[model samples]
Every structure is written in C-alpha cells, then in structure tokens.
Target: MASALCCRARSVSSPILSSARIRRRLPLVGAFCVISLGLSNLCPSLSFKTGCAQSLPFVPLFKSKFSSQSQAKSSGSIRMASESNTVPSIVVYVTVPNKEEGKKLAESLVREKLAACVNRVPGIESVYQWQGEVQTDAEELLIIKTRESLLEALKEHVKANHPYDVPEVIALPITGGSTAYLEWLKNSTRD
Candidate 1:
C-alpha cells in the first residue's frame, strides 16, 4: 500500500516521465511523499490539499482547476498536504481598477516574457486608504507566475505599464508545485 501510494503521488502522465521513469528519477521525493501520506492517514488533521499534493515528493499528486493562488485561497479552493518544500517560483499579485486594464497588463507581462502566466480575476472589491483618504472600488486582480529571479524585471515592467500611481505588486514564494509544472514555468519565462 505504501509503495502504491508513493507511485500514485509521483504519477505524471508525461511522455518523458512514465510511472517507471518518475520513480527512477525522483526516488527520494517519492519515498518522502509516501511517508508523509502514511503519516497523514495516521493524523487526519494533517491534511492540506493544495491541489497537486505538494506534500508528497516525487511529483504533484494531482492538479487544481484554478491557477491563481490568491483567488484559490480567497475561495477556499483546496486543502493541500503540508510536507512539500518551497519551489523556486513566485506569485506576483497586482490589482487594477478594472478588468480591461488588468487584462492589458496581464497580456503585456506574458507577451514580454516577464511572466510565464497571468490569471486575472475580476469583481474583487478592495477597500483601503490612499493619500490619507479612504478609498473603495471594485477591482480586478492579476496573479502572475514566474521564476523568482524575474521578480525585479517583472516589477519594473509593471511599474512602467501600470496606470495607477502605486499599484499593488506583492509576491509570495511558491513553496510547492508539480514537478512538471514547475519545469514548464522555468521553460516559459526568461532566465
């Protein structure tokens, strides 16, 4: 059962990594995931289903339908496992006054290779103080995904293209993700 669980945890149906290849390529991650899975069963409260089961090691246990971490967190999307290591990815969160502007910025980032992917979520209501005045507005959120090294460049690009005098550009490190997806992320963005 433990071996099967490990196999399942690392399973990614890619042409490059068949089940056998995954096990061979990531033996340690697979073993670690299997151990974690066993422990989770022992302690039901230890479950945090972060979509692709980053807790387990060989690879992602599964994938999530949603791509944006901020949106997913806001919606209580999934409960992921807890043992996964932080990957070298960063998620940049930016807010725009409207969806159209958000779309433009998102497209620009991806097109410029500053971001691997950008998820724009509309209808988000934001309330904050700006220039000593309380402000409220319906806003759009842009979740940008890319390698951590691109943060500086991404920030510069956003500052240049963003319409707001001070747009919210926050980033959180990607602690865990599917091995294949992370590889894709690395491949998609500039070094």
Candidate 2:
C-alpha cells in the first residue's frame, strides 16, 4: 500500500509538479507526514508501514541527537528543567517619541528594578492609525529584559512613566540563551 502511494505520487507529472511548484509544496507534504506519524502513534489503526517515509525522498525525516535513553544520560550539555532550576526570561519592547523620553524611561526601569536592562534604540519611524486617522511619527525603541514574573509590574511602571497615552509595550519570551546571561537577568530583576 505504501509503495502504491509512493508510485502514484511520483507518476503525477502535471505542471503543478514542476521544480518551483514542488519546492513550494514540499513543506506542506513534510508537515502532513509529521502529523500523520503523530496520529499513527496515538491511534494504532492509522500506522504506516516502516519504510513509508523512506520511500518519499522529498519528505525529510528528523532524528534527535538524544534518540536513546543511554545517549541522553551520557550527554552532559543537555540538562532537564528539574536539574537546571532555570527561571523564564522575557524581553519587553516599548516605543517612545524621542531620545530624551527613551533615556529617561530606560534609566527609571533599571533603577526601580522593574527591568535588568533597557536598550534605547533611536531613529525608528512608526506609522499607525489613531482616532480613525493615519499618523506617522519618529520614535525610539526600548528593549527591556527581565524575568517573566515581573511583566505585570513592568507594564504598570511603563504606563505610569511613558510619555504617550497608549504606549507600545509588548513582551516576548526568551526561550533559550546563554545560562550566565539568563542568570544575570533573573538576579537583576525584583521578585
């Protein structure tokens, strides 16, 4: 059945199977295979035969470095969450009108312990709609790094100190980074 499907896929020689078209569709095919494999594991009835993925050259098969328990135990570089005691870190962005306000806000955030570090990036242009009208303004961007636990306090502080009525304050999680830098960020911010 798997070979039949593979043959069918190869035999389809329409214009849609051209080089560029194949490139565009390969990702979708790979995603479908991944989802199919996951579903097959969850429901035994949907399982594909062992060589199904191998038959399709365009579909990528990914193997993790720690595929076996022995390999995982032997590796010293990879530490489990329970072992690391790591805290989640976040990077918050805030845009201000000018350099003066950006500098003031960055200093205040660091001084108040609301953020570990605030980087002031100048010469940014912002265009958005406000009060049913289009508006454009020159702005500076502030990148604040702190613990995820301090997000609410950080937002409140920015709201109070920012010059704009509706300040652009957005936070993005720092998924992974250098352990030393993450530790510094965690220690620098207030609990």
- Give per-candidate clash totals: 8, 0
The per-model lDDT (C-alpha) reads 0.74, 0.77
Instruction: State each model's C-alpha RMSD to the native.
Output: 18.0, 9.9
Residues 1-191, model 1: lDDT tens digits = 54775477566566665666655657777677666565444443555454555434643433223333444553342223122222378899999989789989999998988888999898999999988999899999999999899999988998999889998989998765565677688778877
Candidate 2, lDDT over the whole model: 0.77
Off by over 4 Å in 1: 1-87
lDDT of 2 by residue, 1-191 (tens): 44455456667877665555555666787688787765544443556766675566543343333234344453433344324655788899999999999999999999999899999899999999999999999999999999899999989999999878999989998776666777788778888
TM-score of each: 0.58, 0.60
